[model samples]
Target: MDSMIKTGIIELEEMEFYAYHGCFREENVVGNRFLVNISIRTDMTRPMQTDNINDALNYVQVYNLVRTEMQQTSNLLEHVTARVMDSLCRHFPDIEWLRVKISKMNPPMGGQMRNVSVTLER
Candidate 1:
């Protein structure tokens, strides 16, 4: 029931940033590592044929966009994920589909957990 839908994936994985994005007071004071994984499917045939950077989807631009979203603090992972997806969709109408996972590494949840993540698709 769950799998990657497209082979033509433009992926950026484990892009890490330290940010304050939790409801707790400590979370705001002590930022945590957030890893962003982005996947996009779109028409890349033209870019492949032309060999022009202009013709291709720019990863740097996408990364910057994600960074801008990540820098802003939010109390909920859902809100952060929504912002990322909304921003991407607004900018890239050509993208047929997109999926994003934002993970908070080693969160202070008072339990032993590796990470907490939220995934959004559109």
Candidate 2:
């Protein structure tokens, strides 16, 4: 008998954080709510067959990485999102594709908008 190879998508969605990130001085001082979402495509064969954490993408580690990056203050959501994407790629070379999104809730745009977001996919 032979095992089959397969690819799978893993997602961590709506990971919330309260971070000080913005272009305006007041916005930074006041801080705001944020959401980080990530999607990863990778080889799932080993993890599926072995049913072991070592063979799979450790999402807890991924969440930690996102949290670490979010804690680092930045002037823009784009920069934050990019840092997350870069960190994940650097740490997990096995990922076939990656997508990262950062959302700033109730942004200080002087309007009733829900949120502003930046997304990067590769």
Candidate 3:
């Protein structure tokens, strides 16, 4: 006999913030808008059977982790993105996979680009 474990994905998209994360002095001082998207994959077997909050990944805590990291300024989106992933790993051992996207809106790169973003997965 074989048993299969149930898995589920939780996504948080378009979470906006006003953060200072860039190399330019103006960007660091003035701050800019950022959008974060996170997709977390984990086993949901316990949550499914128990129907208890403790058995599932608490999104409020996840959001707090994101907010805490976002508040700290970074020179590169990649660095901040990595920090976010690291935080998730520290908090949630059940996460089997993660995808994180950090977007800086209206980056001052001397161009008409709307945004620049970095996506990381593991």
Candidate 4:
């Protein structure tokens, strides 16, 4: 038997923070805005009826993990995105796959906005 469930998109925008994640000295001290988007895939067959939070992946807990990751310092967006994915996978073993994206808005670049992100599956 095959069972799969689609958990709709969960997005967190304009999550401002101060972090030393840039190569430049000035950029490290002056942080920028970070946006995170996470998509979680799991089997909802059991949780659908039981209505037990433990039976399924808790989105609230996922959000908190992202927040906690942002608090840490990473010099690369890829690292940030990977950390988010790893954290989520560890927290919710029921999840079969996860897609995580992290964007750094309004970067130190002189011209247009700076946005970098990565997607990972586990």
Candidate 5:
């Protein structure tokens, strides 16, 4: 018999917020709907065996961190996404990999685009 370590991914998807993040002044003032998604990869061996929240990555804490980052105004989606990734990595030292996506809905680009999004992975 052999013991194997398992890798697990915990994903938080489509978390929505109304934030003032944009290049335009009107966008900063009026704000817009935004969606955030995060995926974190970590060792799942302990959590799988013990079935304990403490042994696993806490999603509530993840969400709070993402929310805090989103609340800070930024002009670029890339910057926001990077901030989220940085914050997550800082808070969770055990993370093997992380992916973050930020989408701005109905952007003021003078076109009929649904949304503009930025993604960062590390």
Candidate 6:
């Protein structure tokens, strides 16, 4: 068996966005902050040698896609994550696999705690 190349971790933190996504009525109307982190597995065999941007995955475009998707309204974080994964796979065919984590900060819960996040893969 041959070992595949890894592109390491790519993270985007504190990406604040206002989206109407939640089960509660106020959540949809009021909206909240969201943070997204994406990890992509790319075949770096060529880029390592050529040192070309096109040879490897373009992460900036991927981040843009995630940002655009997060702007839309959705009922659940799972749905948003799935959409992100699908979009990423469609845009970047070189990616063998991807992990997307969507976080909803300061959820309507009455407790003082960190945000809620959902991770999905494709």
Model 3 global lDDT (CA atoms, 0 to 1): 0.93
Q: What lDDT score goes with residue 14 in model 6?
A: 55
By lDDT, the candidates rank as 2, 3, 5, 1, 6, 4
TM-score of each: 0.92, 0.95, 0.93, 0.79, 0.95, 0.85
List residue ranges in candidate 6 displaced over 4 A.
1-14
Q: Name the TM-score of candidate 2.
A: 0.95
Residue-by-residue lDDT tens digits, candidate 5, 1-122 = 12476887899999999999998999899999999989899988888888899998999999999999989999999998999999999999999999998999999988899999999999
For model 1, residues 21-119, the per-residue Cα lDDT tens digits are: 999999999889999999999887776667799988889989999999999999999999999999998888899999999999998988999999999
Off-target runs (Cα >4 Å) in candidate 3 are 1-5
Error of 3 at 13 (Å): 0.8
lDDT of each: 0.91, 0.94, 0.93, 0.72, 0.92, 0.81
Q: lDDT per residue, candidate 4, 1-122, as tens digits?
A: 23454343434444455565666787677877777877776767766767797776677788889889888888888887888888888887877667777777777778886676566666
Clashes of 1: 0
What is the Å distance of residue 62 in model 1 from its true position?
A: 0.5
Candidates 3 and 4: which is better by TM-score? 3
RMSD of each: 4.8, 1.6, 2.3, 3.4, 1.6, 3.2
The alpha-carbon deviation from the true structure for residue 104 of candidate 6, after best TM-score superposition, in angstroms, is 0.3
Superposed model 1: Cα runs more than 4 Å off: 1-7
lDDT of 6: 0.81
Task: Score candidate 1 by lDDT.
Answer: 0.91
For each of the candidates, give the backbone clash count: 0, 0, 0, 0, 0, 0
lDDT of 5 at 62: 95
* Worst-scoring 10-residue span by lDDT in model 5: 1-10
